[model samples]
Target: MLFAHDTEVSLRAAVALVNSASEPETMRTTADLDAFFAEHGYTGRHTGGADELAEVRRLRPRLRTLLTSDRDTAAELVNDLLRDAGALPRLVRHGDVDWHVHAVDDDAPLAERIAVETAMAMIDVIRSDEMSRLDVCSDETCDGVVLDLSRNRSKRFCSPACGNRNAVAAYRARRR
Candidate 1:
């Protein structure tokens, strides 16, 4: 794998979080915010509260900006994330896992943890020249973002189901 297992997980989680912000003008709500974080398995003891939920909602657009940013823009944002929250690079192992870098501080707010973790993962991607692998979906009708990890670097859809569904539709249209 290009990164450690947890790093990969964090990157994908970032993509999912970004896509959740791409909703139309009318449908985003607090419940929608809760559902987005919940689906992504974001766990925090006190993050179940409303203010925390609101912070997650606020982060959505910022994450989305990262998805479409140029390398310079993304680097700036990554730096801001790290600097704003004082991310420290510490190697840590907990819960039976092997040692890995923890950019997050234990006392940091949930959003700060998320920002630092995501920024640290982006640091890895940038150093490896793999930042280009991060992408938004190519489905003309959907704005979902995705992390492309294919061996051939050819992924264009956020989900396989969306890829197949759209492909079949295109095929039928050509046949008709």
Candidate 2:
């Protein structure tokens, strides 16, 4: 694996969280937030209210910036996030997941946890010189983050939808 299993999961979760804010916000209501959390396998305390949703929404842009930043800029942003959240890393295991770093309390605000976890995971990414794994979607029409986790590092599209669209366009071009 290019990174630890947990790091990759956290990075992909961050990408999903950032992409959730693209266009008309997908995470609009408490129900939407609940669905997002469930989809991302987010655990721990949740108010499932407006305040929590607001905080997460507020964090989306910052996370997006970090994901798309250059190596030095991304490193600075990751450090700032870790410091701002007062992250204290500790090894913990929950659910079907094995031991991994949890840098914030389980009772901390959900946004804070998400930010810190993303930062911690990014530490691995930066240290391993794998920042190339973070990328923007190659689709000309889609502005979304793409985590290139393929073995050959060939993943270029954010989702299968984008990939299929580009594929069809390429096939049509070949016919022409």
Candidate 3:
């Protein structure tokens, strides 16, 4: 793996969270947030409600900006997130997961935990000079973030659907 399991998980979660704000907006309600948290295996004090959902949604744009930023700019943004969240990294093991860093309290706000985790993951990305792994979708019609974690780092589009659409278009053009 390019990074630790938790780091990769957090990075992928950040990408999904950012892309959730794309057209057709998938995270529109508390149920959506609940599903998101569950799917990402997020553990903490989740005071689920409309306000919490909105706060999480508000973080999307900031994360998107960070993903698309240059190395230096991304580092600055990561620092800002850590500082604003008052992150204090600590290693802990829970459930089936091994020891991994958690920078915020388990009782911290969901948004703060997400932000801090993403920032902590970005620390791995930046220190490893792997910021190139973060990218925007290559599809012209999509603004989704792409986390290129593949072995060859050949992942271009955000989803298989986007890749399939482009592939089919190219095949049709070739046939014509």
Evaluated with TM-score, which candidate comes out highest? 3
lDDT of each: 0.74, 0.91, 0.94
Give TM per candidate: 0.85, 0.95, 0.98
Candidate 3 lDDT over residue span 109-172, tens digit each = 9999999999999999999999899998999999889999999999999988899999999999
Top lDDT prediction, candidate number: 3
Q: Over the full model, what C-alpha lDDT does candidate 3 score relative to the true structure?
A: 0.94
After TM-score superposition, what is the CA distance of residue 144 in candidate 2 from its true location, in Å?
A: 0.3
Q: How close is candidate 1 to the true structure, as a TM-score?
A: 0.85
Return the clash pairs for model 1, or none.
none
Which segments of candidate 1 are over 4 A away from where they belong? 22-45
Cα RMSD (Å) per model? 2.9, 1.1, 0.7
Worst 10 residues of 3 by lDDT: 17-26
Off by over 4 Å in 3: none
Arrange candidates by TM-score, descending: 3, 2, 1
**Which ranges in model 2 have alpha carbons more than 4 Å from their true place?**
none
